[model samples]
Target chain A: MPPRIQIISILICVFLVAYVFELVRRRHLSEEYSMGWLVTGTSMLILSVSDRALELVSELVGATLFTSTLFFFGLLFLMVICLHFSIRISALTKQVRTLTQHVGILDHEKRNLEKKMHQAPWQTSDSSLEQI
Target chain B: MVTPEDDRAESVSYPEPLPQAPKTLIIIPAYNEGKNIGAVLDGIQKHFPEIPILVINDGSSDNTETIAQQHNAEVISLPCNSGYGVALQTGFLYAVKNNYSLVVQMDSDGQHDPANIAVLLEEAQKDDCDVVIGSRFIGKAHYKTSFARHAGMLLFGTIASIICRQKVTDPTSGFQVLKSRAIELIASDEYPPDYPDADFIILMNRNGFKIKEVSVTMHASPDKESMHHGHKTVYYVFKMFLSIFVTLLRKSPKR
Candidate 1:
């Protein structure tokens, strides 16, 4: 019922609502691919608004509730980057597989051509490759 | 203990007609063919009872896997439908691990005649080749294929022949027989998943593997529409040709 508690509660609701809407709007979160960031954000927002925890932590760290909330979000952002890179690594691995296959095919053709040249009546070495 | 005679016998026909014959495995890649998979398997079983069959259920949400299982076919359900290329690759890998001497791939749809599999295997067993493709154009049948599909196939065949530097009649035909050595090489990730018909010919040729086309009968799929859309046909052709160009330009894998 205190004024500070009411203000913190309203702020927590605002942060949680904004976080949920932003995630939905940007299409970052889906049923199948959720990274649990929304849950983390909700928990952080609640903890930041808890008057007892805020008073004790603010007293010890000398930081306001708003700054504490910002810190939690920054941590979430870092986690998102990590998750993104993991997906990218998987995609790159598939690409590397395809590239290796292409390289293999070309190398095989070169060897066949070399063998053909050696069997030819007028054979030329690599130095004279362009003449033929 | 494989003598030259044994090698000679292998190149002659399917099942090899020997007591110590190598096991033959057939892989059918199915996508959304709930109705046709059952009939295809039935016809295959009736024709080649000795061969074990495996169906690569390419992430079909339908009863393809269930029906395949019902027909006593081994099923490897891909987590998602990667494409026809990946489905066949999975089957090739299965063949390699299981030590199958020969692996045959037939469309799960009833369009591909299972009886022709025996014909392909006979040609494949001949010691000179690694890949034997079933060519509808080669056989003396009614050959009722559409002009558009035939044109597409011919174009692919011509491009593949140029890239592989060998004559190829049906590059896009999915039905074929592959030797164990060819299977090991093809089981790798490089095989194209969509429109693999052309890329595979070039891949085999580059690996110093012999590829030959034999005439076989293939009926039109009772189901009219192909899995690929009209736009996808263009995309598939572009990607297939581009990959062939790039593959031709790249170096082969070292032994």
Candidate 2:
């Protein structure tokens, strides 16, 4: 890779790491989810700074071109991020369903209580007296 | 046409009546069926005047709740539009909590004929089964359904019947009668949150619940289209197959 391109990639990686850290500090992104991005950003920074490491990675990955190795890692990172999102979404769907069931049951109970209150005005007074 | 009075008379004289008619509650899960709910409730009231009806208004953006209330049917409005399974499960939970011995669940779209509630209840008692399903495919009732839906039903019916070790003709039928035991099981967390069709039948069977099928007449909604319309038919088939396969992998739930 050209020195200018390497310098630019290093800068972008640094920016990514800094941004993710800032997001974590502000409690916008949780540390649990940001760990993957942090690792990816750090690895990209290391690969951009070290030409020998980049060359070894390209050879190890059997990529004819260094840029192809970079592209492959980028795609792999995106796929990992997507997989993480899918796992989170699955958990969230289960949670939402459970919450909805609770809401439905609670709503039904509330309606029944209100109906009871309407049917017998003295019951409310009895409850108030008991509370006092 | 069978008059409401005739239907009531027939139900009263049905063979093998219980020592006392079980305290039955009809659970109607309504989703944006304001236009049709009134007629459905009226039909139920006309035929089964003694039985109380509870309508779970599943966050419809229409006057479903109001219409049900107007017809003197108890309305339990879910805060948001949950799926069909959630709505039905809510009713089951209510039934279990209120100590209803027999709970009959039917759709509010008028597809499930209220007149057949007697048939389902009788079958539940006669067969000594926990659940009685009203199957459309069994009877001579000319229920007009789309070809794609019928094909999908056939596929699911075969898979469910094999897993359940019994012939399940209409696994997707909403008209069902559940005894207290079955209601307790369904009210638990084991019930599917989405389409609880054939997979639910298999789950019930695995959980030691006896399920029997009774033939009943069902009609399509006048204005509403089938749930398996167009591209949805393909997605429905795929999702149902996957759900059934997953259900097969799950262990038998504890009683």
Fnat per model, in the order shown: 0.00, 0.69
Most accurate candidate by TM-score? 2
For model 1, residues B1-255, the per-residue Cα lDDT tens digits are 233433443343355366666688998888889999999999888777778898888779899989998998877776566667667777787677668989888888787777777678778768999889887676464456667677877887888877777888877777888898789877775666554667778877887888888877667778853444333567777887788888878787642
Which regions in candidate 1 have their CA more than 4 angstroms from the true location? A1-132, B1-16, B225-231
Query: Which TM-score does chain B of candidate 2 obtain?
Result: 0.90
lDDT of 1 by residue, A1-132 (tens): 256755766586567657766777789766334445555556555555676755665567666564554465547665875787689787886765444433433443464576687788775566676665
DockQ score for model 1, please? 0.02
Query: How much is the lDDT of residue B140 in candidate 2?
Result: 62
Cα RMSD (Å) between model 1 and the true structure? Answer: 18.5
Q: Show pairs that collide, candidate 2.
A: none
Q: State in Å the error of residue A25, model 1.
A: 21
lDDT score, candidate 1, position B231: 36
Of candidate 1 chain A, the 10-residue stretch with the lowest lDDT total is: A100-109
